[model samples]
Target: MLPPIYTWLKASNAVKAIIGNTPRAYRPGDAPQDVTQPYVTWALVAGVPDNQLSSTPPSDRYTVQVDCWHTTDKGVEDLAKAVRNAIEPNAHLTAIPVNNRDPETKLYRIALQFDVLQTR
Candidate 1:
């Protein structure tokens, strides 16, 4: 069975820090109920090839993806930044909106791709 959503979020220390210790609110409002609350339906981390590292063919870059519901567009930008910081602190991360349903469900799903050079 899939792990509980809260467990998944808490599994990462970086994620925990980004979202403080507090139960998130589920209601549609101006402010998020708590720091830990995610309007997110799903989130994950992945790795990609590092083509720039010609000397190191084994090197790979890290990436993160987040699917969430947003009440406003303003929060979408910040949410992406928060996600990047949570997953890739050292690497430069960029978020792109793969699917956006702003007025309908207010859901703003984004896929953030970045490069985290692997080291031995």
Candidate 2:
């Protein structure tokens, strides 16, 4: 299932506001030992709606999903932390889950979900 369009838009806007204005850099000489390469790139994927079911009635809740891609594990973790820090500070943001994908290759992708409460 997917979240509603409005939820997606809100989440996308939040992510863009957090990441798009942040300053970042890549120093070739400051590369970590675990990372063989001297470069890293990070980007936040557009928010998507994730459908979720409720245990009680026929009601459902929507989740906003965002993905972050990095060239190294450290970079991915850093970005994930940044995302959590960015969203958790908002009073409207209820819950957030950050997941690390398996198959550790040259590229790492972190999936972030920010759940919004349906009721007050």
Candidate 3:
């Protein structure tokens, strides 16, 4: 997992205000058995973060796959939408939301990819 993504999520008032520091699983293959509902789990889907070549590489660019899980589809979609809104800290940075389901666990999942460019 990219540390910047983690840091952004951790420090995001938008996210915290919505979820209130709920459990965030870094690159988790499976949600923890004891973890509460409407939580977050993420995984590294591709390459490491690349440098944003803005004259002096002042920022890094990367994609983080964020998954929102909940018992109900409504809950999953709502949480996912909140995640999408929360992660958008900048105009150039955005998250694409997709509806999905975990193949193994068969839980409702709101999959999102946050395309980010953060200052170094």
Alpha-carbon error at 106 in model 1, in Å?
3.6
Q: Record all residue pairs in model 1 with backbone atoms less than 3 Å apart, i.e. clashing.
A: none
Instruction: Give the TM-score ranking, best first.
Output: 3, 1, 2
- Prediction 1 TM-score vs. true: 0.43
The 0-to-1 C-alpha lDDT of every candidate, in the order given, reads 0.47, 0.44, 0.64
lDDT of 1 by residue, 8-107 (tens): 4445554444444442312224344443334553433665555564565455655544454445554555555555555454455565646565564445
- Tens-digit lDDT string for candidate 2 (3-120): 3322332354443443343222122243345643222232222333334475433333445554555666777776656655554543134333445554656466665566543431
TM-score of the candidate numbered 2? 0.40
Give the Å shift of residue 114 in candidate 3.
Answer: 1.5
Question: What range of 10 consecutive residues in model 1 has the weakest lDDT sum?
Answer: 22-31
Which window of ten consecutive residues has the lowest lDDT sum in model 3?
89-98
List candidate 3 segments past 4 Å from native: 1-3, 10-22, 29-31, 46-56, 91-98
Supply the global lDDT for candidate 1.
0.47
Q: Identify the runs in model 1 with alpha carbons over 4 angstroms from their true place.
A: 1-37, 40-59, 86-88, 94-99, 102-105
RMSD of each: 8.6, 10.8, 4.0
lDDT of 2 at 36: 35
